[model samples]
Target chain A: MANLVNYYIQFIKRDLQLAVRQKHEFVLPLLFFVLILILFPVTVGPESGLLARLAPAVGWINLILSLLIALPRMFSEDYENGWLEQVFLAAVSPSFFILTRILSFWLLYCLPLVICSVLLVPFMSLPFDIWWVLAQTLFLGSLLVAALGSVASALLVASRKGSGVLALLLLPMLIPALIFGSAVIEAAQQSLPYLSPMLLLAALAVFCLTIAPVAAAQAIKINLG
Target chain B: MFKWLHPYAKPERAYALANRLYLWLWPLALIGLFTGSLWGLMFAPSDYQQSDSFRIMYIHVPAAIWSMGIYMSMGIAGICALVWQMRSFELSVLAMAPIGAVFTAIALFTGSFWGKPMWGTWWVWDARLTSELILLFLYLGVFALFYSFDDKRAGAKAACILAIIGMINVPIIHYSVEWWNSLHQGASITKFDKPSIAKEMLWPLLINIFSCLLLFIALTCYRFATELLASESHRKWVTKIIQ
Candidate 1:
């Protein structure tokens, strides 16, 4: 299936190329994330203990929100430019394309943000040792967000609804990710056994990853029809 | 496959069936509801611990169970709709959503009324309560999704997919919320264990549960009929019925 692989790679390259051309597609989420990081420290006051205690929560919650900003990237371009019928049809296995498209968006949207978040961990008043655990959980949480967000975005293509409905359909599903992601951080801080939450996060991400692409492919087709 | 299901798959047959079932269902639901509430509220001896406040359990327990049950049924309807492309199931999904949302709301309110006396507050982030709140949100989302599309069929498909996804999520969410936090009591009744309630209290609660299910079915049948008629007014069968 070399042809299939090529088509998948081509679609991902196109998504990345478009983001590079716009410059801001990826930058905006990063900017929003950094702004949230700054806002928390200043607004919540500069007390180290309090900031440290609140940091994991503030960071995880804002990261989920920032990722929400990046959600439409998964399928919106193909949808808006009417390339979906062609691009999705060109690939015999549309789920492959769907997976890659979300993967690229996740790479561009979540990776840099997660790395930046880890780099700034000291500023969030977290222990330096937490970097590894923090990075692991952030990656998993963002993966889950990308998967769920892509499905929601695909559904939106059919519905033509506003962002409010998207948020309504989405936020409730994000709860477990929020709970476990923050738990991972808190566990790290306390030096308690953090493996359970991280494993849980990994399970969530993988589960969504498997299901989202297929469901989204169906949604795009149904919506486009 | 499922050859017997073919005739009932037709909107006309399903609508007529629902209409016939409604006649029986509504009266039974009403009579059962009245009897169950009277028995549970007035006849059941007051709980030694909760006393009079425990009386609210009649409403709260049934509403909570059926709120979840309704969503599960919607999920089943969704899967059938997607698999068979059954428009009747789609209509049923839409018809049941508001009622599901209402049941969830009733559960929450009755819960808090009991909680204020027992838990010393109107609300807590307990596992059951939070998940119930989330279920309400799911109902709102499911209902809203159905109307969001320019293409009604497309909207139904998308909402069906979402309901299925939500059905899958509810248990995961329930357990996760449990792991995250909980303060409510364990199940008051169970299949294996002797029900934790007094025998006298348990019978009325059981009656209330079944009556609530009947009420839900009766109401959904009524609404499903209306949905079918509204969507297919120009169809000959619908027109003939109208005349």
Candidate 2:
């Protein structure tokens, strides 16, 4: 048990150190996320109510997209360098590696989105009360996105096809999260009980957290074979 | 039972069985489709409310049901392939993708046509249509994933993982959509409650359902056989058959 824990910790520390060294991977997606927020108001016109109404959806879409943009980095580096095959075949289980990657991704990619959305919320004219709800939804939803997106990244890591197919495969599964995240925000906007959708998103996060690593491990194994 | 079923674990035996089944399935499918369409389009009494627009239900409903059915079978084939490493099951998964896509497209198109006159709009964000749209996307994803790989076996395995994942998600997607629909659209416009279906209408629909299933089986079997043959052309049995 201690050995397994040590392996997981070591994996996270290694990936985080890589993430710090290659700050561009983190900065590029962050820039894209900020650019999406800035561009939406310009494209849709600066009407505050419209922006408020559209903010939840636009934010959620951008959140998923930004996460997606960073997804290729999740496995491609290891895959390209051939370390992924070594890890898969190594004494350490691939699932732990996948889980570590998912955790670090949520920290580096998803965590930043949640923090920045705090600043963007009031700028978009959304209700303050719903900000808390949006925060809750984004936190959970980002974890789900990271977990699910890692699976897609693993599957596509070895394939020559780029992010288009990855998006095609990932986006549909992301819908429920998108729907519930925005729905809870909308619910909070109307002062209705938003707890149900929040709970549902939690369930989805838990479900993804459990299944994605195993599936990702299997996908990596298949790709390696 | 295990003894009887053991031979089919071999791809050669399975392909032969699928080939034999296709011989019966295609003709039966054609006859049933024609008969069902005739009965549905002409003999079935018009819906009291919907009248003739409801005749589209025969095609739409069957296509919709089979779209889901094909995915379910694909999921089963995926599990079999994963568990036993059966090449036949992998080929079946590949063969079923286009068939499922076509059926899903039929369902969506016929659904919109039926919707135009009934709901006064060609599209609605209701649960059934929304879920069907997602199913279409799932089918496209399967196709995209399959063709993206250089190694066909690896592609099939990856697509199988996706199929199994998708199969698990379908029910959750359906339930979530249902909840979303109920909350947003109060009392669905697309509810085809089985208990409410009249006998006259139900009979023709049932026949069409059977016909559609036969059509799926026939098409899938033929496609699987062709795929099997192509992949196995250098093998002894394929050589003998070709000779």
lDDT of the candidates, in the order given? 0.84, 0.88
Interface RMSD of every candidate? 1.2, 0.8
In angstroms, the error of model 1 at B167 is 1.5
lDDT of 2 at A160: 88
What would the per-residue lDDT of candidate 2 be over residues B145-202, giving only the tens digit for each residue? 9888888889999999999999988898888877877877576665575348888888
lDDT of candidate model 1 versus the reference: 0.84
Candidate 2 accuracy as lDDT: 0.88
Quote the chain B TM-score of every prediction: 0.93, 0.95
CAPRI-style quality class for the chain A–B interface of candidate 2? medium
State the lDDT of candidate 1 residue by residue for B38-90, as single tens digits: 99989999978778888898999999999999999999999988998888989
Q: Which residue ranges in model 1 land beyond 4 Å of their true spot?
A: A119-123, B1-3, B182-195
**Model 1 chain B: ten consecutive residues of lowest lDDT:** B183-192
After superposing candidate 2, which stretches have Cα over 4 Å from the reference? B193-195
